[model samples]
Target: TWSTDGVINEYCEPCEAIVEGELVEVPPLEEREEFSLDGVTYEAFNTSGGLGTLAETLKGKVRTLNYRTIRYPGHAAIMKALLNDLGLRHRRDVLKDIFESALPATLQ
Candidate 1:
């Protein structure tokens, strides 16, 4: 039987077509602060699960929402070193297909 009735998750809200708007990304920190590194910098990149439409709807109501691009802590550094320093996003589609073909999916 085909049905759209049992699709949306517990936290999901039917927003004004999540397709129409650009993804909403909010940094994890509620308060914005400045930081010092090699060059003067401020804390901005934060991580949160932007699983589909989660962040887009929570705008303003919640101080912060999960960022889509940035990773948390070591994740950002590691991924940057791999994806940027080494470069991987370019061939991601091929890698994804290979990985999917090699590893079998398990249903819980």
Candidate 2:
């Protein structure tokens, strides 16, 4: 799901059927919240990361299955600005170029 080239696909092709069957959808960006772990607080928000497939496979076996992507504070805001405010969502090639150019690969 992640790549050193900065082009990560968030959706799993194998999960598409499960997602459609379950009507799974990502929550609104405004619903994002912060959580603390090891004294560090990070922002998390629901995304189409293929949780529905796992949920469907484990139906009745587990009480719940939820998935979210975690990122540094304000990361979501920047994404919202780029994808919504600047209308980059419809222009993914530009967005991908921006990401590849601005975000350097890190070992950490």
In order, the Cα lDDT scores of the candidates are 0.38, 0.59
Clashing pairs in 1: 48-66
What's the residue-level lDDT of 14 in candidate 1? 24
Question: How many Å off is the CA of 7 in candidate 2?
Answer: 5.8
Instruction: Name the top lDDT candidate.
Output: 2
- Alpha-carbon shift of residue 4 in model 1 (angstroms): 26
Our tally of clashes for model 2 stands at 0
Highest TM-score among the candidates is held by which one? 2
Q: Which stretches of candidate 2 lie over 4 Å from their true place?
A: 4-23, 27-30, 59-63, 106-108
Candidate 2 on 1-108: residue-level lDDT in tens? 456222234421112222334533444344588999999999976555446467668655655455667888997788778777988767777877887788776665
Give the Å error, residue 75, model 1: 4.8
What candidate 1 gets wrong by more than 4 Å, as runs, is 1-49, 67-76, 94-108
